[model samples]
Target chain A: MTEQQTGDVPSARPYYQPPSLTGRPQPANLADILERVLDKGIIIAGDIRVNLLDIELLTIKLRLLVVSVDKAEEMGIDWWKHDPMLTVRERGLDEENRELRERLAQLEGTPDDEEGGQDEGDGSARGRQSAGSRSRGDA
Target chain B: MSDMPPAPTSADGPEPSVPVSDTATNSATNPATDTVTDSSTGQGSEQGTGRYLYAVCRRLPPGALQGVHGLSGEPLELVEHGDLVAVVSTVPLASFGEDALRRNLEDLSWLESVVRGHDDVVQAVAAHGPVAPMRLATICFDDDAVRARLRQWAVDLGYVLDRVTGSAEWSVKLLELAPQAEALEEAEAPASGAEYLRRRKAAVEQRAASSASAADVADDIHATLACRAKASRQLPPQDPRLSGLSGTMVLNAAYLVPDVDAAEFTAALDELRGRYPSLLIDARGPWPPYSFAMLGQP
Candidate 1:
C-alpha cells in the first residue's frame, strides 16, 4: 500500500499536467474563482432592471457575522486582532474565550470554589453551543 | 474534457412555462414588440432581452472570439466604441430576468455554471490582449446600451485596461494546522473539577501563544509577498467547507504581479515555503487580474 501510494504521488502530477491554463475551465478547484467573483466585491451600478414581481435578489450569508463590514476592522470588536486571518465569528468566539480567561485568572486570585464551578459550567455550556468540544479550529 | 459547450439546461433553471415578461433599463425609448417575450400583467414592457457584457478590451481582432459562447450558448461578439470593444452576447429575458435571477443565484449549481461561463468568455478575451473583465451578469438592454455604458465608463475602463495591461493575478492561501496537545499524563486525571479546569486554562493559554506565533508568520508571509508583487489585496479566509482543506486558513490573498516578475514571485514563494514547511502555502495563478481590475472604481 505504501509503495503504491508513493508511486501515485510523483507519477500522477507531472505526467498529466493540470490542463492548459489558458481558456480551459478546471472544475476541481473552482472555489477560487467563486471567491474572486463573490467576495472580491465587484460593483455593477444599474442596468439590470428586469422586473422582479416576486423575489428580490437575495444573497445568503454562509456564516453568522458577529460584526458587519462597516465596523469589522475598526472599533476593535474583533477579538482576533492578534490574527487578521480569523473570521468575525471566530474572533468573536476568541474574544469570549479571552474574557473568560481573564475572569478565570481573577477567580484564581480570589479562592472561590462556587464561582469557579459556575464559570466552568458556563464554559462547558458554550462548548456545547459551538459544534463539538472545541470548534476553535473551525471558528 | 472540460469547458466546451456547457450544459444548455444548466443555468437556465427549469424553463419557465410562462411567457417571458419584464422591463429592460431602456424601457423609455423602444416600446415592447410582440416578437420578443413581453406578456406581463401591468409592467413597463421591453421584450425581456439584453446583451450580457463580459469584458472590455482595446482594438481586439475581429475574429478574436471566432468560436466562443456566452452563458447560455450565445455566439460571442464585440460591440465597438471607437477603439474600445465590449465583449458581449445575447441573454434571454426569461432566464436573466430579475425574478429568475433571484431564484437562479441561490442555486449554487446554476450560479456556478453562469460564473464559469462568464469567466470562460473573459479568459478567451484576455488571451488576445489586456481585457478588463466586467462583473458577472453585467446586462444591457441592447447593443446601444452596451456602447453607451462603455462610452460612459471609458476613462475608468481605460485605466483598468492599462493597469492590468501586462499583469496577472496570483492567489496565495496560508492554512494554519492545529498543534497537537501532549499532557503530562502522570498516573490518572486531576483530583478536583477546579483543578481540571485550571489545567485546561493553562493549555488554552499555551495554544493562544502558539497561534499568536502562527499569526506573526502569516503577517511575515503577506509582507514578503506584497513587496514582490505590484499590488496585493487581502481576501477573507474561505470557509473550510468552501476551501475543502484541513486547518484554519491564516491568510487568503491575491497579488497582481507583472508578467515578467512572475518567476521571481514563485522563487520567493518557494523560499517562504522552505521557511515554514509545516504551514500549507497553496499558490496558483496567472489569472487575468480579477482582483486588480477595479482600478478606477470608487
Candidate 2:
C-alpha cells in the first residue's frame, strides 16, 4: 500500500473546504453525498382528512430537484466567489459602503451640478496638489 | 363520506369512515378526525400523528424489510401495490407533514439528517436490487395512500430501476498539485523588465503545459480503467470548498462497473497512480449508483 492509500502521512491543511461557506453541521463528504441527494428523486405527499392545523401548519412537502453546482457556476453566478456563504455571511465593508451610498442618496436627492464650473476648477487644482504630494511621498 | 371513526374491526376490509386509533380519549375525540380538523380548522392538539413515508420502489423484495422503524420510534410497515413496496414508518404529523417541511427545509442540519437517512434506506434496498429512493421527507397518510403513489408513479420508478440495475458507482478524484521549485523562480523578483516578462511568459506556458499533461494523465487513467468498467462519465471538476478536499479537483468522474470486475476496476486505478507521478488519482467505490440513477430519464 502506498502512503496515499493509507492516508496516514501528515499533510498540510487543505485550503478549500466544504460543509457550506459558514461552518455548520453538514455531511463531511458533501460533494459525493450531494450527488445522491440533489437528483431527480422521488417525492410523496398525500391528502389530509383533518382540518385542525393551519394550511401552513399541517402540510410539510418535500421538494427534491437535481442541478449540478458546476452548471450553476457555468451560468456565471460569480457571487459564490465573493461570498461563499451566499446570503448567510455577516455583512462586511462592501455592505457598509452600499449602506452609506444609499443613506447619502436618501438624504440628498440626486446631485445636480449647482456650481459646476467652480467645482471643476477646484477638483483639478486639488488633484494636481495631491499628485505632487503623492510623488514626493513615494520618493 | 361522513366524517366518523370506523367501528373497530380486525379484518382487511375498507371502511367508509375515517380510521382513528382506539387511544384517542373523548377529550381528544378521534385522532384521525382531529388530524383533518388541524389541517382545515387551524386548531392545535393534532400534535403527535406523523405520516410514515416509505421507499418508493417497484418490484421490491416482498417481506424483505420487516420490523424496521424510522429514526423516530414509529413502527415501519410495508405499503405495497403489485410489486412496489414503500418501506414506511409513521412520524409526528407536525414535523413530517407538509407545512412543517416548508418551514424546516431551510434548516441545514435538519435537511442533512433527513437526506442522509433517506439515502441510507434507499442504499439498503438498492443493495438487493434496483431501488428508487424517494425525495427527502415524502410523507404518505396510510398504506392505501402509499399504494396509490406506487400505481401513479410505477412507470417512472421502473425506468429509474432499469437504468441502475447491474451497475455500481465509483468516485475518482485527481490528486492536488504539489508545488515545485519553478514556482519559486517566478516568485523571486526578476533582475530586469525583459527578464521579468520572459519569466512570466515561461510561467504561463508551464502552467498550460502542466494542465495539458494532467488532462492527458486523466485520460490515460480513465482509458485503462474504463476497459474494466461498464460505462464511464467525466463529471465537471468539483469545488474544493464543496468537497472539503485538499488541493484542486482535476477530475471528478463516476464509472459504472460490473460487479464482477469491481476488483479489477480498483486495481486499474492503483496501477494508474503507480504509473503517473505527475498526477494523483484517487478512487473509491462499489457504492449504489447514486450519481447515475435518475427517474424519468430518456
TM-scores of all candidate predictions against the true structure: 0.66, 0.57
* Model 1, residue pairs in steric clash: none
Highest lDDT scorer: 1
lDDT of 2 by residue, B84-144 (tens): 6666655565775556755556565675676666666666666677666665566544444
- The B-chain TM-score of model 2 reads 0.68
Over B159-202, each residue of candidate 1 has an lDDT whose tens digit, in order, gives 78888888888888887655442332232588864576566555
Q: What does DockQ give for each predicted structure?
A: 0.16, 0.14
Q: What digit string (tens of lDDT, one per residue) describes model 1 on residues A6-79?
A: 54454332222222232222343556777665444234443666332221222213322223332233222343
Judge the docking of candidate 2 as incorrect, acceptable, medium or high. Answer: incorrect
Candidate 2 residue spans exceeding 4 A from truth: A1-28, A40-139, B1-54, B58-63, B66-69, B96-103, B178-209, B239-242
Candidate 2 chain B — worst ten consecutive residues by lDDT sum?
B1-10
Worst 10 residues of 2 chain A by lDDT: A59-68
TM-score of 2: 0.57
Query: Looking at model 1 chain B, which ten-residue stretch has the lowest summed lDDT?
Result: B1-10
Residue B105: error of model 1 in Å?
A: 1.7
Which candidate leads the pack in TM-score?
A: 1
